[model samples]
Target: MFDSRHIQTFAEVVRTGSYAATARDLGYTQPAISQQMKALERAAGTPLFVRAGRGLRLTDAGQVLARHATGILSTIATAHGQLKAITRLESGRVRVCAFPAANATLLPATVARVAASHPGIRVELLEEEPPDSLRALREGRCDLALAFSAGHGGDAAEADGDSDEGLVEMPLLDDPLMVLLPADHALAGSSRAELGELEQERWIAGCRHCRGHFVAACAEAGFAPDIAFATDDNLAVQELVAAGAGIALVPGMTLPLLRHTGLVARPLAPAVGRRVSAFVLEGHETAPVTALLLRTLSEAAADMERAASGFPRSEA
Candidate 1:
């Protein structure tokens, strides 16, 4: 059996690339670091590191062990945190990744609710796109991921074949993409806009994924948009529209989040929307803090949907 201390020492060596550096970081003598490495090698019956000039390099076996060691260390840290929280639901940390709009709208309210209910739990939020957020969840870097899928499928969790990773996805909302027009634009008087009608107008493209959807949606309408600017910031897109730069297709959820004036948003004739969802590792759902946060997020999503329905419709 390999000691976790030795495994951690090995991982540190791989990261720092030198026994002397590892010793300095871990407060151990260089000889002690060497002793641990040798013991680790003896246990595995292979040389984990090879002398390369003045420094050291991991052998193939060492590289594999280092990879596993990093994961093992992360798991141990997470287990320690959970155990600490289990002792008393008083304190725990939940790492979450979300896209920008969700961060602005959904996460703040949800996090506030979680904080009010469980003052001891700390929620760390990271802004990431859907793919990156899902990757973080799969790699154990985050406990939960707020992600979205458009026309591709229902839930991102169900779309993955890595059941062994034990991911559970819950659908949150169907946030439609809407057309944003300058307040005095010719189409601003309409309740909705067709893609074909805007063929002559300059356009502002969204993020890469959203731009792809815009392109595909426009192609389906038998015309291509004249994209004038490409950006991921919804607020920037709105600002540009207000300045009459170009029209844009923005997610409906962003409407309430935007505080900017002088622009009107109308639903698309054949509404296109993204389905937002929360993804968590299967076993995490049972944790008290995680469960509470999940419930809070659900409540927030419901509230947003209700509020969105009452939002003033664009008119002349």
Candidate 2:
């Protein structure tokens, strides 16, 4: 039987990318970690890692083993929790990563609520873009990831099957695009504005995906928008609009999060909204705590929608 110690050593080496780093982290002598890796290779009857300069690279065989090892170790840790405790509220950790807008809006409330309800569960929140969050979730660096995509209204990348291999995505909410203008703009008091009315106005552009949303929404309305400034930060976009640099089509949820004195938000008459979803690795679904968190987050999103509807109408 392969030793647990050897498996742990291999995992540490793979994570740190160096035997010396692994030794420092694990507080073992460097040679001891190396010997454990050798033992692992011998048991498997194949090379798991290849020497690369002063570090090591996982051989194809090693990559496969590392993947399984990550799952196995996580399972073992969870099993221990299951045997020792009934409620995950007592002690555990949930790693969450999402894009900035989510971090600014839904995430803080969700995390704060979770932390308050389950003081024992450590909630580690990270601000990461979709690509990085997806990568982190697949590699076991995060327990859950919040993701967004521009659906029919924009040019969305074809969904890659491998992009969700080990994870199951749950649809959360659809956020429609809303136009943000200077509070004194002629159309700010209107319930909704048609895309064509703003065609000639300079635009404060969103990120690549959101830019697709604005550009496509306008194209559908028979005019191509003139984006004068492109920025990833929604707050910055609102600031630009307040400064009278231009206008922008931002997500509905962003109205509450982006605080700007001179900006007013109004939905487009024919709305375009992006779909947002939460994903958790497949095996984690069985854990009661993970399930609870998912349920709570979904509920929070529903509340956010209601809050969006109640926002005070701004006037020009």
Candidate 3:
């Protein structure tokens, strides 16, 4: 009989590309990881890995076994979560990671809804850039990650490259992109702002990803912007816009937070939006707390959109 623990160790080694790294992640020594792999190979009477240049590559048999191991481990995890939820011990910890703007706006409501629904479940929030949030989900540091990317005109183009294995993404909401300007600015009274009209004004760029997104949107309208301020902090970007430092492309969900003495948000004329998405490492979907949290987040986002449009939302 194959030891599930040995199978897990072997899978980790393959996923991490080195026994040393796998050992560090699993809290075992390098020698221990090697011994576990060797023992598994001995039991199966076959070599699982071949030495590559400074690393290891899975043999055909190893590749097959690793895949099976991953699935088996995931199934076990799901079963355990189900059993835990069944006995009314519906308590478990989940970490959520997201970008600053998302953290500032969507997360508070999502957390509130989850807390009301699952009083026993504990959720800890981690602030990270989108790339790091996705990484956290892949590496098991976070159970779920809230990630966002520009809407590809309603097509399902994922925000980042699909490098993380066994991951799934669900679109939560379409947050309309808006132009935030000084309250007394000439364009503040306008119902909508065209991308081309802002070409001569100083602009605040959020992060590299955000900058790229804005630049691409402007290119669609025939100009590249002159960035006067660049920051990873969404609040700072809004503060700069409020202080008349420069204008910014702010998301609609963020408008409520930025409603201030010196700022006004106007929808874009061409109507570009970004989709906020929920990510879960696949096979962990049946975890009750995680599932409930995901459902609450999706419903909260829809409620926010409805509220913004002055539509009646059912009681929360």
Q: Find the candidate with the highest lDDT and give its number.
A: 1
Clashes of each: 0, 0, 0
- Candidate 1 segments exceeding 4 Å error: 1-88, 152-165
* Model 1 lDDT on a 0 to 1 scale: 0.85
lDDT of 3: 0.79
Off by over 4 Å in 3: 1-89, 151-161, 311-316
On lDDT, the stronger of 1 and 2 is 1
* Candidate 2 lDDT over residue span 225-264, tens digit each: 8878999977678778888999888877777776678777
* Estimated TM-score for each candidate: 0.69, 0.69, 0.68
- What C-alpha lDDT do the candidate models reach, one value each? 0.85, 0.79, 0.79
TM-score for candidate 3, please give it.
Answer: 0.68
User: Which should have the higher lDDT, number 1 or number 3?
Assistant: 1
Q: For model 2, where is the 10-residue window of minimal lDDT?
A: 153-162
- The total of clashing pairs for model 1 equals 0
